[model samples]
Target: MAGSELTNIKSPRVKAARRLAKRAFRDRDRSFLAEGPQAVREALALEGVVAELFTTAEAELRHADILFAATHAGVPVFRVSGEVMSELAQTVTPQGLLAVCRFLHVPLEQAVTAGSRLVAVLAHVRDPGNAGTVLRSADAAGADSVVFTDASVDPYNGKCVRASAGSLFHLPVTVGTPAAQAVARLKESGLRVLAADGAGERTLDDVDLSGPTAWIFGNEAWGLPPELLRLADEVVKVPIYGRAESLNLATAAAVCLYASARSQRAGSESGPAPRLP
Candidate 1:
């Protein structure tokens, strides 16, 4: 890492790995791309989660500290060309560095709700940007978990990953079949399921989010599925004064989640939180 000479990375192994990364094969192979010097640096902080690092001359010079940290962590570091870096990067601009890291699947059982859990359940949310924004808000509001179910966009998808601004690596997020089961299990485990519905009569203010609650935000066009609606202990709406018709799904989610955060914080300031139903 302290060497003055530039490292050349033109090995067949790097090529094959970059090729595999283009397909879902890398993901299927239990790895993902953490591109950009900033992203690579953020991901490297995860240590064991980040298995390897790739860089070009620009990254080595511009992001030397990042490269140094990855090398120091004993992660496999390879030097490649800017062209190859572009090939491996999901985005248009290559930040000169990328990382191949093992994907740590968050089991439904381990998803932040071990106890005193406040979670967000995003159901069939189609927009990766919306989904990612929900994650950013959840991170900011200190929610225990953010779960997506029913063919929602992959949170690990490049757009979602970037939209999360690296928060995807910050929290417990579960995707896949276990997600559906996770919802039912949370309900049975005394976690209140509150679905966000503009049509619903109950306002978010009416619900006490101070306790264990899973705030469910559905897709933009279709909204919550009938079954999920039936599963909710209650459906809450964010009060709208303007004639704007409706808020974006992610905005609504931030409103709902932060409302809960605000209520929880206020409750903490006062006496004990009232028993939430």
Candidate 2:
């Protein structure tokens, strides 16, 4: 494996890595930044994503296992100065690690039918952190894939990636898909699309989630509009048992996804989907 200790923050290589912080640059280059030891390690573990890795001298010493893994995988690992690492990292207190990774998203058509029994679709979500958390939750709940509608934040955004921790690289994610098209694809794949909202007449418990299902979570502020909600087979709400007005996007998503996962699993273990007469 090739390696070099770089100190110059103005180096062309350093500048190129920093450019990934911008959405336009990321889109143009078809790459993004994965920062910190955990994210970098995950990026290296996945095949054909970690193009190059940058680490500080201190990090090189502290995270020797990660460095060795990258080297074993034939990834180019560079030892950079603390300043250079900071410049590449989005966090204020850098973890002395960062990596240049190719885009991990797939097309909406490919993603919706990637043999996913349950999928989470975000419609017009704007917050990067919220989007990331939802992705992580979907992964945690054993969701097959996550899709971000065209109006949503970039799933590859630095903040979203950071919030996902290492889950970003764990599952299939689709971005820049329109809400209507995404819903149509999921439904065509035999998934019952359910829109999550606060005013739905049906609670999540009323739904039979054992069948293949796609759950659509709306934006942070406005939630799903009437038109988007109408695309779903049904509108469901998470029961608010407490004084809280409503659950946020991430929390609602987790609850909804987990319900489907558990129901599907139970149905599989006990009996198959019922057949019509």
Best by lDDT: 2
lDDT of 1 by residue, 1-277 (tens): 4233223335665665565544366556677767776667778888597877777777788887887788789887777667667666777977877777777558777774548468888788888888888999999988888777756877766667778877788888887634458677777667878889886886776667776778888889878877877778888888776888788898999998888887777774443334458
Q: Candidate 2 residues 1-277, lDDT tens each?
A: 3366788989999999898899999999999999898898888888999989888888888999988988888888888888788777899998988899999898887788836699999888899999999999999989889999898999889999999998899988998998999989999999999999986887887768888899999988778999998989999999888999899888899999998988997874544334335
Clashes of 2: 0
TM-score of each: 0.87, 0.93
Q: Rate the local accuracy (lDDT) of all candidates.
A: 0.74, 0.88
Candidate 2 lDDT: 0.88
Kindly report which residue stretches of model 2 are placed more than 4 angstroms away from their true locations once superposed. Answer: 1-4, 268-277
Clash list (residue pairs), candidate 2: none
RMSD of each: 4.0, 3.7
Clashes of each: 1, 0
